[model samples]
Target: MNQTIQRRLYKLYSSSSRSSFGLRNRISSLGWIVVCGLPLCAFMASMYPRDTFFQLLGVVSAVCIAAFVSVLLRKAQLKVRRLLPRHASVGRPLEYTVEYTNLAKRGLNNFYMLDLAPDPTPSMDVFLHATEPGEEKRNAFDRFFLAYRWNWLKSRFLLMKSKLFLANSVGGEKCGKVRVELLPLRRGVIHLQNMRVVLPDALGLFQRVKRVDQEEDILIVLPKRYRMDSFDFAGQARSQVGGDSSTSTQGQSGEFVSLREYRPGDPPKHIHWPSWGRTGKPILKEYEEMFFPRYGLVLDTAVRAEQEEVFEELVSVAATLTSEMDTDQSLIDVMFIQQGAKVQTVGKNVERVEAMLELLASVEIDPVADWAALKNAVLKHADDLTTCFLVFGDWDDERENFLQSLSSFGISLVVLVVQDEENPVKLNSDYTEITLLNVGEIEQGLASIHL
Candidate 1:
């Protein structure tokens, strides 16, 4: 009962805040009409008391009323369609075109259109609660006056009130296009709700809004990627048939398999001299494929409620490594526990990078995911992986034991532990691949990895 009441209270507050913002904007738009029109009409009537001026005032008032009524009655028969990309990167500006077609017989004049965008960033209330008590207390007043609460409220209202006027006239039975640019401040899914058209009176004193619902376009904003030149892991390459021979080829550089007719781009070194001399034709030597490095990226999704920010940093690190690694030359396997333990494999030839990023964009902390299940998932792929990159939020004993167990499998392991400034770096003498990185200085820590 208490939870229900609290929820109701929150909903009420949110609705009231949004309504207040809309009211403020509406007043600002028509404030001059009320402030000047009423007094001028009264003053004119008082001074002229009879014919000319009073009659002129009545005529002006009637015209204003007729214009307001016409605007209110005007029906905009518009078809709105949006063209947007499938994905966006964080901190990058994305531009999409919105096409509006006037299907009515009469043309639309002096009208504005706006695309409704939903905010995906965390709310101010969540941010305040995430901060320490001292910090929260220090900024309590600012939070009340200068926080995103009002901004979100205003934005929510403007989605219904504000719009972009068509610079050029949209004739009847014609189509017009407008481009909208949005800069995503964070990583998440942004839902494009609808397009709103506002038709205002001749004097621009009153606006009539029409909302045209479109198929919701969901844009996944990927996490920011960092530059990583290379990642080196300590392990012996496994030999496999039909595998890349760049890293694990044994004997005289490569094992020659067969000779084939030389192609235009065939290197001179690969040309079989004996075959060319015997057959009197250009021949190229084919070698057995070498082993390609396969790396496992284990993301620790088990985070405490308060340590959500740490998980975000861990995700960014994972995304950066995933982007920088040569998927074409090597295979990357991403392992994380969502509902259950799951693994996604990506390679140079595959177009799964966007899928992987989409998964990462919506990943949330799941405390219920057992550590044993996560361990088993990684172990299942141990034989195929040449090296494994483990991104963890905390370096607890359980996690250390998990890494130790992975190291026992002889697969090279690189562990990146995200910690706060207060937590001193803990050196692990048992493993050579462990690197401690403060959440504030991830780039420096990643750059310091020598092996």
Candidate 2:
């Protein structure tokens, strides 16, 4: 095995004492030490007259007993391996099992284990129990190696592994491992760190916790869901300069068209069979390709649209729109209002629009910049923009002017105002105003815009 691989699999050292604190171990240790020391000290004071040698013998006796107990403890080693789910989806519950094996000479009786998880993993229920020798259990709590406890004092051993447990005998002694399964509730990359296993000495006294050195990382990506419906491409097919009508966007009706005579290098689908039959020549059937009107998703990513969740909804809407365009083979463009410089697409590539949406997820809205400047930048691609979806938190006179002038460009417009109810500026309502109370409504409401 590689050095890096070994480091990830078998690490069992702790750096700080404070990192291993648990309530049960502290109380037991304190009680035992106090009980063992107070009586011995009082006896030594009374016996000093008889012989000071006896007093020295008492202190040595305590040291010997502690050392003997420490040496008597069975040597234990813990191993952790992560078994992740093969098929996982974002926002869905996915199981991740952490299997722990204990190779101790005796059972780790009533030990409490806590797994350290990073931010991405959702909260999970965990249990530790020793398995019987040669026994294999799958998703079963009855075979756990250690007992769990709610708190130190109310701790009681039960076979159920609800809050406490006792490790079953392994080989000739108590040993073996337990598996903890976790459900990931969110999408993106997740990293799992080392687990801290806390075990106290006999009689539930003096807890000692050891950190396992294993590390696990997993990635969960959500599949894209693209939409295909209600798009206009009649005028676009007719405008293709060199591409064939069957493969082109020029047409008057939004329907599939038939193929004509095939050129030398024409796509096989474009070869018209019926035309070839009637005229004894090859022809192809061509469907009119649709193109969605380009709309600049100008998010006020400046200081105003600082709420990350709200920004994500805008990006989600943008991504869904781009995916729809890609499915329909339509044309749409995007631009950011507060990104210092203008951003846009040249022709009808929906992939370019998807990239722009990802950019919107990180961009911050600016309040100092002039909205007019951004509007003018959009004018450079004014002929291409079918409409503008201005996602902002507030309404202003300048925004009204921008929308009013857009009608002259022969484009439809929709203004999505995402703001609190206490927004001071009353909207003029010259154009369609969608007050975004919830960000999720943006996509559903966008369908109403006929442009």
lDDT: which candidate is best?
A: 1
**Top candidate, metric TM-score:** 1
lDDT of each: 0.69, 0.47
- For model 1, residues 82-170, the per-residue Cα lDDT tens digits are 79888888767777788888888888877777665563233545433343323345455654443444444333323112235453468
How does candidate 2 score on lDDT?
0.47
Residue 168, model 2: Cα distance from true site in angstroms: 12
Q: In order, what is each prediction's RMSD in angstroms? A: 8.1, 16.5
Model 2 TM-score (2 dp): 0.45
Residue 319, candidate 1: how far off, in angstroms?
Answer: 1.4
| Per-model TM values vs. the true structure | 0.70, 0.45
* Candidate 2 residue lDDT tens string, 141-188: 422311121111112111011122233334423335554544433333
